[model samples]
Target: MPYIPLEDHLPGITGLLEYSKDTAAPIRELTQTLLRGPSTLTEGERELIATIVSHRNQCTFCVTAHTAAADILLGEEETSTKVKQDISTAPVSDKMKALLTIASLAQESGKSVTPESVQKAKDAGATDIEIHDTVLIAALFCLYNRYVDGLSTVTPTDPAFYKGLGERLKNNGYNRLPEGYEHLKK
Candidate 1:
């Protein structure tokens, strides 16, 4: 029940990207590049940023998809869910969890991520680059969250859909949809 017709069965941002290959091609590429191009931020960290932001926005697609992505990056589904549920207590290194917390706060309220959040990140061993990237990643997801949910995009509730796709997105990225993405046949 998407607000708009979704070509793909799962009806999420991927569907929107595939459907709008002509108009949103540039945006798609930029998102992928920001995610996978040049950055010291680990894949899981970026995905965590996205998940945290999506959670703040209550965006179903981003939360589900990036949570899966984070899990894949950690190579453990259980830890993935734990971190996604509450990063503070996750088994991840303190630095990473701190970043996740910062991202979450940022998502909750852009200005609410007080200087203390930044300091907490630093106290947890976050570098300047990591801090900067964490903010940018959170900010980007805010836009993405709104874009997908605001337009009434086709976000699905299926875990398999996002988990399987997460594997591919982590390996490759949004630069191009995984081969046979057309196989998302219901």
Candidate 2:
């Protein structure tokens, strides 16, 4: 059960977003711009940043959703799983690993991100835009993780559900809710 009353069938952030379109509208746009919009980082890379931060925060809902999205974008879920398990040894490029390190520190505390982290990302071939976006994505997920977990939202236990959600998010993008989002509306 959610900390606040929400539609019984709607889970996680879906219900929370639907509960107030006023807030959801802007949040939706922000996500669309951050995760779906054009960027030097591939969609998979951006989603990976989000997934890492969510994992650091111990927010199961955000982690599950973003992990699926990252996997869908990357064409393989295992790679993302490996990165989450150990970014240093993951099959991703050195630049990605460097960016992930920055994301991890951002998840801990924005101030924890140091000049060295930025320089390491640059050394790994990450551009200024990539570094900036990685930090933003990491900080954004921290807010999202808190939003989902703080409300005690209902998290789906089934992997298939998250997989399906990943497809929906990838195909439809976050500019608007998925087809079934209407069910949560008053």
Q: Per-candidate TM vs. native?
A: 0.83, 0.94
Q: Write the per-residue lDDT of candidate 1 for residues 55-154, one digit (tens) a residue.
A: 8788888888888888888777676667767777877788888888788877777787888878988998899988877877888888788878877887
Model 2 weakest 10-residue run by lDDT: 177-186
Model 1 misplaced regions, further than 4 Å: 8-10, 178-186
Candidate 2's C-alpha lDDT?
Answer: 0.89
In candidate 1, which residue pairs clash? 11-154
Q: After superposition, how far is residue 74 of candidate 2 from its true place, in Å?
A: 1.0
Error of 2 at 87 (Å): 1.1
Report the lDDT tens digits of candidate 2 across residue range 1-186: 789998777799888887887998988888899888989899998999999899989999999999999999999988889888999999989999999999999999989999998899999999988898899889888889999999999998999989988998899888665465665344
Clashing residue pairs, candidate 2?
A: none
In model 1, how large is the Cα lDDT of residue 164?
84
- What lDDT would each prediction earn against the true structure? 0.77, 0.89
Deviation in angstroms for 53 in model 2? 0.6
